[model samples]
Target: MTDPSDAVEADRALKDKHRTMWALGDYPALASRLIPELGTVLVRACGVKGGQRVLDIAAGSGNASIPAAQAGAHVVASDLTPELMETGRRLAGEAGVDLEWREADAEALPFGDGVFDIVMSCLGVMFAPHHQAAADELVRVCRPGGTIGLINWTPQGFVGQMFATMKPFMPPPPPGVQPPPLWGTEAHVRELLGDRVTDVEARTRMLRVDRFARPEEFREFFKACYGPTVAVYQHIADRPEQVADLDAELAALADRNLRDGGMDWEYLLLTARRAGQAATGPE
Candidate 1:
């Protein structure tokens, strides 16, 4: 068995690496273009209403946060990357929405228990090094009877397949670390939330990426703006053969999902309500 201390250290290292990967490239430019519709969907699913306290954990570029705020919720957008948070600030301003942007980690949110009426994450939180810790934090800060909404990329989806394709070029994850896509499955979500929540529901949605003209162009766009893709490109920069292989694989994957001049990216939308207060005088 791995030493407990070593495991902790490994997790810390992994989180640092994740932060670096996300911090690289201009994620907001891509997020602003691709995530607004999904953000609207998640806000609706969470039942966010005027005057409600909403927290968007790992909110990339304020996509969900701006919508929730626009709908009249008192929104707080949190992320680990300062650059991303700044991007969100600018986006919120541009949209004429007000939001409280905070630099926070998903595994360790800096909020009081039962504070928020709704907790939501968009293609975020699942990237945390400790899945259960992140899940617990989401529930802990949410008031009883409040909703938790999430959008995650499914393992069998195009993005997941792309990540798998790049796995050969990247280092293996630490032992016992779960892939972020696990949050996309109903069974895993159930396990993560356990008995802490009720009315758990999950549905798959197809999000389209249509900015590029061709599969090769799509791959190149990601390489320029998506951090993970940029990291992969940088890693294999010296290996021409490996670079060619990566490009070929990504182009093929993108082509398989292409339709109407865009690619269909499938993701899971999850919603659940925290168990409410028990009746003091039961029947």
Candidate 2:
């Protein structure tokens, strides 16, 4: 029989590994420069107001958290990687905004039931290995009738295709770890959140990413700046031929996707209200 303590220890070890992986690349820069609009959009859509308590889970460098705070809401920016959260804290300070920053895991958030008015994540939380556990937590900490906002890359989107392309060269995921892009699908999220939420509204939006000057630039930049892309390359670093092959593949992908001086990545923006106050844990 499996010991409960062993399961707890295993999850902790996995989280530690994830923390290291996220801190490996220049994610804060990407979040700030390219997708900063996403955070603002989500905050506005959720109607974040002054005096509301907000939680930004998996908030890498406080994307959603900072904007919500700027809107006068009390925001807590929580993430697994302290290094990433530290960058957000510094940015918030410079922007003359204050946010409570905490190191946290999405599957097991360190907050009580129904403690927040709005819980949001921007291109975050979807990365949690255990999707159901994370989804339950999102519903758990939110007050009944409060909001939950999310932005995730769709499976048919450029970013999703990039991950699919990279999968062949990457290491196998641990058991029970779901693909992050699944969160972007409407039905998938609806199923995950289940009946614990109401007023479910989700829509796909196109985010034209014009960050790269040239098609090849996309591949090179991701290899250096994106944690997942960087990790994949690092894993195959010893295999020069494999690295060369992956380089060509990624460049080709960028070339195919790039147009009108940019690439269009699709994302889903979802909002729902928490339901029963007692439906915090999964059955």
Candidate 3:
């Protein structure tokens, strides 16, 4: 049997490779074009009023940070990947906004206590291995009464359904697989944050994502976005052409949404707030 650590490393490496490829294009404009007013929506959800010190964790390609900066907030954007940050910096610069971009992890933040008025992350904390530690870090750095805003995927809906369908195409893990649980669910997130934070409001926003423009676009996006899953097929499939068929099948499954300009993907947007009142109450 293959060692589990090797599998993890391989998967991580594959994801990193795909992320690099995805970052090669015009990131800011791509994001802007793909998700119109996404930044504005996220910034507003984060309660990022002007002049507030905001920390955007896992600031991938300025999905959250640029909007905050544009909203007149002093934003500190941090990410685990430097390449993503570089894209973020270039995008922010092009927008004529000065943002402090730092390379950091969600579990280990490099900030003083009670320094920020808002600590926000969009679709970031859910991927953390030690989600509790990440949640603590978000709270630790926020001033008392400061808000902690987050956007995570909810377990149900379209994205969840896609994962279920794609499971068969994924490689099998060795015994004792112990993959991380889906962290976007409301119950799971609340448990991860524990009882400390308050005014915790978790709601899902239905986001329509254009997964691809057409069948050809689907092929390109999958090759670009899906990493090891395709690599696995290349190795195990009896026939390589099976991969093409699989792509066609998936495109067909998304036919209603893909018939037009792009495939419609539903994304969950979750939001929560840090409590200023007694911690014992509901969050």
Error of 2 at 84 (Å): 0.8
lDDT per residue for candidate 3 within 151-258, as digits (tens), equals: 764445444554454567666644432222355576776776666577777666666666566656654554444433345445447866767666766666556446
Model 1 lDDT per residue over 169-220, tens place: 9767776678878888878888999999999889998998887668898788
Q: Over 4 Å off in model 1, which ranges?
A: 1-9, 278-283
Candidate 2: tens digits of C-alpha lDDT, residues 207-283: 98998878788988888889999999999999999999999999999999889889889999999998865334311
For every candidate in turn, the CA RMSD to the true structure comes to 3.1, 3.3, 5.4
Question: How many residue pairs clash per model?
Answer: 0, 0, 1
Better of 1 and 3 by TM-score: 1
Would you list the clashing residue pairs of candidate 3? 198-275
Q: Which candidate number has the best TM-score?
A: 2
* Residue ranges of candidate 2 with Cα displaced over 4 Å: 277-283
Deviation in Å, model 3, residue 10 alpha carbon: 12
Which numbered prediction scores highest in lDDT against the true structure? 2
Model 1 quality (TM-score): 0.93
Error of 1 at 236 (Å): 2.0
